[model samples]
Target chain A: AQSVSQHNHHVILSEAASLELGCNYSYGGTVNLFWYVQYPGQHLQLLLKYFSGDPLVKGIKGFEAEFIKSKFSFNLRKPSVQWSDTAEYFCAVNARLLNNYGQNFVFGPGTRLSVLP
Target chain B: DTAVSQTPKYLVTQMGNDKSIKCEQNLGHDTMYWYKQDSKKFLKIMFSYNNKELIINETVPNRFSPKSPDKAHLNLHINSLELGDSAVYFCASSIPLEGRSGNTIYFGEGSWLTVV
Candidate 1:
């Protein structure tokens, strides 16, 4: 079974501060990665996704993540963050095959981000 | 338009009671999933249905059953609910499992279940 681990449980940052959230997965085959964010009272929204091709993928709201196969990591990064960026972020991984039921996206314990103004 | 939607945004029920939460998606996707988010915000997949067929059933208890009447609806029914079942349940849908470059899941506003 594939599992996802997020190193940080909570993160606090000031406005305009750079941010990085660590995420690592345990999978040996082809995998699809995603970063999803949920605001205070909103549903989970896709931040970005990495299927194939480039390792670095940019997402909405000025967020980006790099899919490092060697490190088994897909870390979310942003050079500058705003107060509105305060939310819970989750890292997920899924295998390439659909019939592989056990390969469904495995989510990590979300990281609560608090961005101070 | 809402791509995914779930009914009873807030559900407060007593223990041992039976309750059902309805989920619907208008995305014309073939795969729908149910995920539970605990108090600590740990998300886990409970069930997934592909084209009205049961595809993925995690180690979830039998008390929690998923019913998909069609391709767009996937409802969750909890029989004899327990306190541990008190969590936020999210319904999500993605493109058909057969023909897709990547599965991008869209989640609905979760249904917060509080078991007393």
Candidate 2:
């Protein structure tokens, strides 16, 4: 089974601090990667996704993620995070089944980011 | 209008009770999903329906049932709810990502269910 692991469970940073959240997946084949964020009392929103060409994908809110196939990692980063960046971040992997019938999704436990203003 | 919406934004029920959460998507997506988010903020896919057909059914208990009247609607019905069932249930819809093999999901505001 495919599983996603996030390196940090909780991260606290002051405003304007550089941020990087490490994500790794245990899958051997072609897979789609995504980063989703959930603000307080809100639904999960798509931060970014990597499907094909670009290893470095830019998403909304000045966030970006780099997909490193060699290490099975897709890490989310921001040059400078603001207080509004506080949220729970989830790393997800979507892989096709061997039977070619359907796809499976594996989500990491999520990392909570608290950006102090 | 909201692209995806779930009814009963907040639900409080006692154990052994039955409840249902309704969902609808106006985005004309062919796939819909039910995801459970625990208190710790762990999100897990419980069920997924594509074009009104059951496609992905995770290791969820039989007490939880999902119904899709159409491609744009997916509803979840929970029976004999237990304390452990208290969590946030999210309804999502997705359309195939063009030129790619994957799909991009859109989530609803979610229904908070508290089983007492």
Candidate 3:
């Protein structure tokens, strides 16, 4: 039973503020990481994913996540965020082999970000 | 074209009633999954189907069952729903990530289920 923990439940900031959402998973084995965003009244959209690559993975809309294997963390970061970046962000993890079988996704309780104009 | 879609974007029913939600994916993905997003916005996998075969059945209650008629469709049926069953149900599809580039799951808009 792998579980992902997100410490921040809600974050409020103004436009241009730096953003970092912490995501830590309990799995110690090879795993795939993903960050998905859901805008108000919209479906979840992929921001980025880490299969096998550099620790620092860049995603859409100027977002990036660092897969810190030692800490079991893949924290999403953005140097600057716009008002349009306001959305509920989810961190998901899937064991490499289990994912290939059924693609079972275990998502974190989302972090809600609100950016003021 | 919509990659993944779910019918009855919103469903409301009384307790002890039976209801179903239908989902279809146009992405030609071999795997389809059902996920429940609780009120606290926690998402968990309920069931997963690969090419119409049940692959992962989470610890969800037996009252909730998922059926995949074909590779492209997955339907969820709930019998004698309870208030705790109220949540947003998401249908998602993804090709196996192994040896694949940028593997990710694409989710439908979600069906909101409310039990009175």
CA lDDT, every prediction? 0.91, 0.92, 0.90
Comparing candidate 2 with candidate 3, which one achieves the higher TM-score? 2
- What CAPRI grade goes to candidate 3? medium
Give the deviation of candidate 2 from the true structure as CA RMSD: 1.4
Error of 2 at B83 (Å): 0.8
Candidate 2, residue B3: CA error in Å? 1.0
lDDT of 3 at A35: 96
Task: Give a tens-digit lDDT track for model 1, residues B27-109.
Answer: 99888999999888889999988889888898999999999999899999999999999999999998753323567889999
- Give the clashing residue pairs of candidate 3, or none: none
| Comparing 1 and 2 on DockQ, the stronger one | 2
lDDT tens per residue, model 2, A1-117: 789999999999999999999999998888889999999999999999999897999999999999998999999999999999999999998876555655666789999999999
Residue-level lDDT of model 3, residues B21-111, one tens digit each, is: 9999999999899999888778888898889999888899999989999999999999999999999999999886564354679999999
DockQ winner, 2 or 3: 3
lDDT of 3 at A71: 93
Assess the local accuracy of residue B56 in candidate 1 as a C-alpha lDDT between 0 and 100: 82
Q: Whole-model lDDT, candidate 1?
A: 0.91
